[model samples]
Target chain A: MSRESVVGTAEHAAESEWGRLSSRLILVNLAILVAPVVMFLADLAITGDAGLQALITLGSLFVTFLVVSGIGLMRLFTTRYRVTEHSVELHSGLLFRSRRSIPVDRIRSVDLTANPVHRLFGLTTLSIGTGEQSTSASHRLALDGISKADAVELRRRLIEARDARRGYAVPVEDDGPISELDWSWLRYGPLSVWGVGGVLIAGASVYRTLHELKVDPLKWGFVKDLEHRFGSVPLWYGILASVVVLVVLGIAGSTATFIESWSGYRLTREEGGMFRVRRGLLVTRSVSIEQQRLRGVELVEPIPLRWARAAKLNAVASGLGSLDDNRKRRMLTPPVPRAEARRVAAEVLGTDRSLVLRTGLTRHPRAALRRRVNRALMWTVLITAVPVGLGLWLGPGLVRGGLIGGAVLLLVLVAFAVDAYRTLGHGMRGRYLLTSSGTFAHRTVALRQEGIIGWKITRTPFQRRAGLFTLGATTAAGEGVYKVHDVTDAQGIALAEQAVPRLLLPFLERDPRSAARG
Target chain B: MEDVRLRPPRHRVESRAVNWWRLQSLLFAVPLPLTFGILWASIPPTRQIFMWLTLGFLVPGLIYVLVMPPWRYRVHRWEVTDEAVYAASGWLWQQWRVVPLSRVQTVDTLRGPLQQIFKLSGVTVTTASASGAVKIKGIDHAMADDLVAHLTRFTQATPEDAT
Candidate 1:
């Protein structure tokens, strides 16, 4: 009866928004406000004339209704989105007149999320993300309040458009939905450092929020309860006790978060060569990536996870998602057994190249080992000296702690350095190049040599003096550049030559004895 | 045992590009300290410290700007081959990079105002690499065009490979 009465104008080239949604939005919002509104009305009736209060209430509501209806009208008729042959163009804003278009070829993923309110109205919010844009604009192109049918249709059309551009046979086949989150995997959640980190972050945020609100957390009911439970403890003991409590809480919080995120996880390899993942307990997320977009796979083993013989598998794809944002949907497997991860990676890639990471890893030269050792020693010295200096500056109370801490840290660093060296290996099995390295989080990458676009050879003054150079393989996929460090110049060039043959051959001199010089 | 020496690249950037870089460095280095010097001179307590700091930054900076152009000219080298484009550059430590003819997505040439004055041009070869686009600066105008033309021909001939 209201805003849907308005028809789309000629200037509105794209189709109009769905259903206005005024009835739904108003009903939901009004229902939420009803309790407070009723309380206010009762108070007004008690304080003033009942009839006048009712009249005022009706007047205000009529005004709210008019305003909401106007907005719904403008939104219904003015806002528009269209799937053109080549692009998804969205136009909104009445006065400013904004138009944004994402080319169909560039659309990497379209994720749909619908809350309870949206589900009631059969609506979904679409997040259209493109892989290659330098700005956050690529991640946040959301189309809100679209019909579920239209959303499905739009995704199909966009996929079709991409297929047309790519000249690939498109199949809508959905295959065996394998691999759900195992309750046993819950063991890995508590083992992760991310749990402790999440706890610390939550505490910091809560502390900040309390400060912003000008509320003293110490005087709060929980703190009082904690204090009562602990009794009047001494200062140092109080600190230690709180620290232990916080750590336990953090572990619990992190474990809960992991379960929530990974529960009901399912992976499906469809007939059309797309790997679709549907996961999440509270907010269900569906991600489908075509096999054509995948470049390689990475096996990441954080030190603790490694200790447990567990690893996480991530797909090295153009626009799978951002790691900085902790979008671990890119991860093929959670912290599972290393062997299990390998199997999962093999299944996901659907190729024999997945086996390349496990075997035939050629170790880097002795010079690389020396470099790591020296670097580790240098860092140990530098880091220890700071604490030593601080102890000296702050007087003698901290000297023993500083010295012990420094020694322990140095020991850890030394072990880490040796592990890093142990991890340093690269292998080439035909077109596939396998490289694995790291200290805390060892990563093994299996990439295609043909995928390499360029070679960047760099030698620091120190590296040059040591006759060593690093060769970074550049590609459009993954983190962009994968580096092989501290190799002899001959080895580096030889590696590059093998990676992309004629490209480096034209530049390298025939002689191999030339050592790098600063 | 075969011995290898640093074989110089086939083409060197225009000598004037050195001056342009120095000029560019000067453009960057001069204003901030000059503004800070004026601000420091306006206040009495900070004047000596400001003078000392400005001298500290500018003296070495001016020396660096002047010396770097020619020293950079000494090191800057590039060669465009039938198979790839190679650029050898850097200051303390050098890097020699190779971007094959097949991988280059776009070849863009820019002529900044100072570059125009120096009769120099810069070419950037953007490939589909995460390391990002490679830039070769201080080419003579004709050479830039010739390089671009050659790259265009190669790019057109092999669109099937790298992308």
Candidate 2:
């Protein structure tokens, strides 16, 4: 049974459930756009300038409503799919019509997902990905609304096509109960709080920057000459202005965060090796990720979650081909605790319980030294400049500032060394090497024997002289790169040989180099 | 296998192309960075590092042009034999990946400006649990249309092999 057969009949049209779901979305989007219009009207009523201002706000809302309604109508009416004997046909688009037929044999995987709304409405969305590039097809298909019987039958047929091939495992029947971690681990901790705070601050800063950029010559005083610029304003006035701006920004940023991150978070693994993750406040999203698309597990134990015997578990999936692109993304699960991360990773990757890929704990020898030195120097410079900078900020002559700078410089040097020491100590621990050497937010991706796809060992001219080489393993999800900064060629070969066999076995039976020739 | 070769009534073009605007900001590209480097050389923090990294950015593109073998590369012409679909590309060191259609998990097409301009597109063929996916690049649009039709047809007809 290949992916093609899973999405069988191209015969079905927009009948019952799909129509209802699409209409609901149109209504939801309409409600979301109503806030700004109401706010605008209230502002106009208070100021008695309701004519131009209210019209502009109302017009924008109307346009927004039209766009959302248009997309909903298009999906409801235009999008249709049919499952064929050995393939699936999808017809989509409004003006630029498209018809995609994907054979059952070529399908890699099919994922089904639904949110709380989708669950209540008895509808699920499906994403089917194949190994080819076709314009007529979409990676995702919204069933809108369908019976449970139809959904199960679709899954069964798709699995039959996919499993028709040998070596591929039959779709697992027992996804197992939502683990204890799902119930206990998901929490909004300090990092989540700080992350929310950071977003707030950034948003406020952007708003302020835009406001400042809208320089009003008449109100700010027409500045025709450099001498009369705002920089020449009184020192007290400058100090007061800066303080007011900072306070306003700080408050706005914090407020923005409190509203955005409200969560009705839920993570569940179904009986069919599919993980469903749905969360978000005003704008909700639901993603169903196939187990095969699972990339790797990220366990972050920041200061806040650490004390609660907790950590945020983030599963990076493959649908987002590159972090730089792809708006529709999937996560095996959101930030759960650290202890649960390993178990979740195992379930998602379908690896053994003990097989953990350690992607951290290696350093690029020269790069490591350079980073530490740079950090040390920066701290020294900051300390040295502080007292002198304070003298200029406060007054021209202010209390023997040179001595103060020297004392601060000594303290900074001590702090820098301690911070650099912990960062330098980070390294990888798994059977396959993954080196994470960065001083802050250090991460490396290591895979056990099963997770890796293929391994390549290569050395550059400069690296050869330094007796160093890099081993990069391409995973289904992303690139797994490990650089042995100063290891011998023999060691490099030994590691590559040992690792490649494990990685290559599932893909090709013979040695890859010889297989390439054959 | 004999029935698989029978042609369908319609031969449609299958393509997914991302326009040039889809690529990352041009400010990070070599030409823009080089221009910025020379202009900002006198400014603080821009003298040495900016110029050096800007020059370094050209290495990948230069290496690609120089080392790439002049094969009449067409990603669209990729074929799926009864056993496998042969997707191969490379200029310096070559890569040939054979993905049995039975093992295929996902098929994706990407079209960037270079591909869009040339009416070409790249196809990615992936298999379950294996990241050794095959990519075929620089195929013309018309050729891609025929290839996708044949490949999908072949995949449907062939019985699943031991992947």
Candidate 3:
């Protein structure tokens, strides 16, 4: 009999139970249910009120964990799934009774994730994303805490089922390592601006967590005996020591996150035009992108990364929703050299195409440079005037200090403005618009002009005086709008008209010389 | 698409839009200045500074309520073609947008309770642009309907291009 015939004959067909280890995995959730009681115990300890009340509280906490664990265990026993030729069915919920089925063809990606706990237990949580950007949380079906063997088997069956339904084995061919973990890139890892702040925040939270448990953090992890011991050292020495220690901690934290997220990062071009990036050490993440969904790529270079000549490659894929709060920017490559980033961008966008991301950009008019400089000077004066004005009003001591500080600040501002002006470039090559702009962390995006849905022209009173306008090419792809600010009015209009041809040309009043340049 | 004209639009909105905008200006102006006066009146140290700045602000605003409405009406222009919708607004700091009909996600007609009293309407064309919606206010009711119908039909006729 055919597969359909066999499924039809069976009763509730091919229902299978996950491994018994899933019950043990569910026990971890008991801690959440009993956390309040634990906090109460900590409070009692701190207050020195450890009597019958403390014993009773501890007993109640134990009972709560027991009951929660029992419910979690019950859930695992009740859950069952059926994999048919057409659909994958899941049934759970003891009292409410919920059933969900995903059609084989609708499955976009099957990803496996595991935390440190799950890794120790040899378990995996499989998530099936339908590639839907809906607000509904049910867009992904997650099978929580299954045996490694069963999870692997289920993943294979689901993929094979999908393949059988569609009739082809998507090549899982090895593409011979696109990128490898190297210490050279590690230097850029800690160079992110967020690192120091992230480390400090994380450290404060950890200290708070320990404090809540009535555990002294100074004794717990941070340098011990520094509580009152810091007073013995000279103030400057203490401050300097702490600064050095904090910087070391920040760099360490940055490297840890970098390794945790992109340690085993590999980008492989699979069969049937699907590319997958599998990385992370303790908590693994596997992101897959279809060739058809990819509109373009973005080179993200933070100020420090830029100075180091390194950039991270992020994909501009359609219908791709972001995942995780951090570490989930849909990146294609780790922090690599600028040359390699350009090469990879070309490769991702396809070298087969006439348009490449590494095209020479056209510089905007001299007026744009002047406008940037003007803006910088205006900001400098506004910032400096506040202190200097207060200095004049308050006393003469502040006047001397204010002038010296203001002059230094003005010089820095001028340098940044000149750099920003130098960075201003816009080019249209083939079907792409290659635009570059930024004072510090410069980004050069090669966006497809066809992806642009609209155009916005902005001209302030000052800009109008300078004959400058900001042209934003609005697309659905990367970060939405790519703007070339402070371009001459004629250039802005011309860029819009040339990028989209007939669309913007209809509304714009054309000037022959600028039109030809665009 | 190639046959589209590069000519500037000649159509002006209904002349009554000037009165409506002035009314809108009044609607916006009254509460804000009154709130400012109340706030600065209650405060002690900055009362003198507030009075001067408020006058500095209110003089231009009073001029706007009386004079800038007609000036704004003179500048604001909108036009629609089979391919796209165009709008130009603002007097000093001018802004314009050409939202391709093919990229329009939604088209809406807006008539507030006050706007309805004037027998006037406004149309908003939403595209996938981060710069926000293209809103053409102070339109004739019948003209608004025509715009909505035309934009709806035009957008529907074009197949969605994948991002």
Poorest 10 consecutive residues of model 1 chain A by lDDT? Answer: A1-10
Clashing pairs in 1: none
lDDT of 3 by residue, A1-518 (tens): 01121233235543343223365567466545556666766666656665665566567767877887777786687777767778786667687666667787767666677786677777778777655432234445677777778877787687778778888777765757555566677777787777778878998887776565455645533366565688788999989998898888888888888888878877777554566777889987666666656666677777888788788887765435423311253688888887777777777777543333334567778877777778788887888788788889999878788788878988898898888888878877766776778887777777777777887776788887876788887765545567787876556656677788877665655455455776
Best by TM-score: 1
DockQ of 3: 0.38
lDDT, candidate 2, residue A192? 43
Question: Candidate 1 falls in which docking quality class?
Answer: acceptable
> What is the DockQ ranking, best to worst?
1, 3, 2
Evaluated at residue A184, the lDDT of candidate 3 is 71
Please give, as one word, the docking class of candidate 2. incorrect
Per-model interface RMSD values are 3.6, 14.7, 6.0
Better lDDT candidate (1, 2): 1
Candidate 3 scores a chain A TM-score of 0.79
- Fraction of native contacts (fnat) of each candidate: 0.59, 0.06, 0.57
Once fitted onto the true fold, the runs of candidate 3 whose alpha carbons sit more than 4 angstroms away are A1-25, A31-113, A117-173, A207-242, A322-327, A352-359, A511-518, B1-29, B35-76, B89-94, B127-131
The local distance difference test score of model 1 is: 0.71
Tens-place lDDT digits, model 1, residues B68-106: 778778878899887788887876777777888887888
List DockQ, one per candidate, in order.
Answer: 0.44, 0.06, 0.38
